[model samples]
Target: MEIRRLAGRVRTAIARADQKLVTFVQSHANLTTALVTAGLALWALSTHQSAIVLRMAAAGAVGYFLGLTPAVCVGALSVGFSVAISLEHGFSISNLIIEVIGAGCSAWLGYQHKMQKVRQEQAADPHAPQVLPWAVVNEIRTSLAAIRFLLFPLHDEEGSRENQALQQATQELSRLEALFREMEQRDRAGEGR
Candidate 1:
């Protein structure tokens, strides 16, 4: 009986800790999004170039939702912004095909990297539930995956942090799951008797 009570207390403690971490992640994500939106809005107002403004705004919006790799979004936006500036200054593209190819290649690379990160995170936390309504596990996985994309193909600072948080989340989730399962089993067994 004491052992069971101790296990219950431990599970409760882990659940509370996980909830706090999840809250922190959510708060940080909201802050990041707000900052991106405000920055893009300000940039849009200051830029005389309408095309550049739109590109920045779109990229910033994507970055905000991605919650990771704001740099990649910024880099992509810069490329398009530079092209726009060049066009405005009378740089003509001789081959539209080449420009399209370049844009497509960059987008493909970004997408592929994002998918690979998702796979890695999934592999790392295989037992974790994929679709829990109350748990922010999927969001955590997504954020971590995107961070992995931003950090690779090298050591990822944000990815490491995300991984740690994800592991904690999974451990907490497992504890809760086990606790509930045990309770359900006990109740069913008593009913049968």
Candidate 2:
């Protein structure tokens, strides 16, 4: 019964955590979108300026922190803007290609960092113990609860009569059910007083 109560509380807590995760992802998306737009606007307004370069850098950093994946949209935009500026600065096309490659590598590194953090969290969070889903848990419990027969050697069955005794014991299921009801009633009455 205590485990049942704990399970109910864990279910509620997990639901709340799921909602928080959704909100967190949405907010990250919005922020990333805003940063990307700002970087593009800056690049369009001033094709060659330190301010544009700084904005591009900021966008790349934010993208790495928020995306949690390589080839993120903001990361792509950052690299795109940087390449365009390099082209405008009279850099060779090869240099622009190198910039894109560097950007890609950095994005991949950021993704790896995010994955490491996730693994660390999983290791540290004991209360978030890994378990089978509810359906699997229910199936296991059901199968165990319905286990009415135990395999026994023929000698044990006849010499000690353990198998027959176990079968007889299983027949006391109704009595156990009544005892459970009585306990429940007593608990309710105690609570009322």
Estimated TM-score for each candidate:
0.26, 0.36
Mind sharing the TM-score for model 1?
Answer: 0.26
lDDT, each prediction: 0.55, 0.58
lDDT score for residue 69 of model 2: 43
User: 106-136, model 1: which lDDT tens digit per residue?
Assistant: 3334444466578999999986443334444
Q: For candidate 2, give the lDDT.
A: 0.58
lDDT of 2 at 118: 81
Root-mean-square deviation (CA) per prediction: 27.4, 19.2
Native-to-model Cα distance after best TM-score fit, residue 8 in candidate 2, in Å: 62
- Model 1 lDDT at residue 155: 49
Maximum-TM-score candidate: 2
* Residue pairs in clash, model 1: none
Clashes of each: 0, 0
